[model samples]
Target: HPLFPLLALLFEKCELATQSSECPSTESFNLDIQAFVQHQDRERKPFFTEDHEVNDLMIKAIQVLRIHMLELEKVQELCKDFCNRYITCLKGKMQSENLLRSDYGGYDSDDSSSGAGSAAGLPGIPPPGMPGGRHSVPPGLIGGPPVPPYYGHPGPGPHHLS
Candidate 1:
């Protein structure tokens, strides 16, 4: 899963947040809709300021690719909403990394800080064949049940066009 690296970063962020008095994990983190919506609203203001145009185009492209039913006006509104949530999530993530770096003085030399940068900077790709490689197993496969292998199957994965 390409998002494995991203998920790892989020897990790390959750660990960091557990240390912050302001970010105590309530049952709300799982079941509180009003608080989540309020948090989203609070985070909407500065999230898309840097790349609004490019962000809009990317949103359109994703909508097109996913075959979402797109009414022009509604899609535009939804795009704005989606981008706000996306940017808010990203900001939270970036903030977590900053906190970790400032508090812990960054990772030790042997760890993959460089890899983290590369993975976060490049969205759908990871360093090839690494443990969290984009093409590796799904991120949530921590010991529960055996996950069946499915990558190199006979027919065609998403890469095949014809």
Candidate 2:
């Protein structure tokens, strides 16, 4: 009995690296992929395995694949939603700018009253006291001058009638 114990101890040198261990981080991802493949191969050997074992393995594989597909779908949906929101916001800004420009002095090419552009009805950026620029009639009133501070100021009121 003492010799048998001594013989077992001599042959029992354990290895730190074995099939059972915590998976490494993504930096060592190739090792994990190889392990997954090896695990699959080993689990499939012993051809006469019970039907229940085969069923269990198949179910596990299906679950992994399903999870991956669901994650990909979520990413796609997020991207689509972001794109739609971005486009809508851009259109709103552009429409507001067009309304502001059409009101300020750049109107249709049919008015034959003033050629100086400013002489027609374009507002000279009226003083701060006037909100609507021309007696509260509102800018771009078909004959009123264009509103002033055209560059950065938010026009009084909504500016967009549409």
Candidate 3:
């Protein structure tokens, strides 16, 4: 609604700049923004809000766009806000979905194997290099070879004192 006009204007300005070789003048930018608002009003179309999550996201987006248009006068803050908020929402949705699936997927809570496993399955832990999928040290003198007893000054065995 109110914010779409601003966002559409910004988009149109961006579009015009990309279409033309020369940098878009301020007048043209402003004109495009006006045209965008006019176009939306003429179409009488509502903002995209089929899903509740999408609707909420769009509201947040509009707020960010409003900041860019009115307060900060730049899109960097809007972009940052969009990315952070959207990612957090997505992560929240994913966690919620996982919880729902775990609750409904008939997971056997009594089974010990569900939680019993080596952390090697986790990400970033390099898989075992040797067989049986377990870590093994390279072949070396790990537990071999006893040092011979040293006689006096590297001479042979001790001789009888005559």
Could you estimate the TM-score for every candidate? Answer: 0.26, 0.32, 0.24
lDDT of 1 by residue, 2-108 (tens): 22232343344345444543332333223332443455578663323356676676445433422321233345566668999999999999999888766645543
Candidate 2: residue 144 lDDT (0-100): 57
Model 3: runs farther than 4 Å from truth? 1-37, 69-162
* Model 1: residue 48 alpha-carbon error in angstroms: 48
Candidate 3's TM-score reads 0.24
Candidate 2: where are CA atoms >4 Å away?
A: 1-58, 106-162
Error of 3 at 43 (Å): 2.1
Candidate 1 lDDT at 162 equals 59
**Which rank order by lDDT, best down to worst?**
3, 1, 2
Residues forming the 10-long window of minimal summed lDDT in candidate 2: 9-18
- lDDT per residue for candidate 3 within 38-131, as digits (tens), equals 7767988555555777677756764554444343333445666788999999999999867855654423232233333223233233335434
The sequence of per-residue lDDT tens digits that candidate 2 reaches over residues 87-145 is 99999999986886676545433233423223234534333235533444545555655
C-alpha displacement of 64 in model 1, angstroms? 21
lDDT of each: 0.47, 0.46, 0.52
lDDT of 1: 0.47
lDDT of 3: 0.52
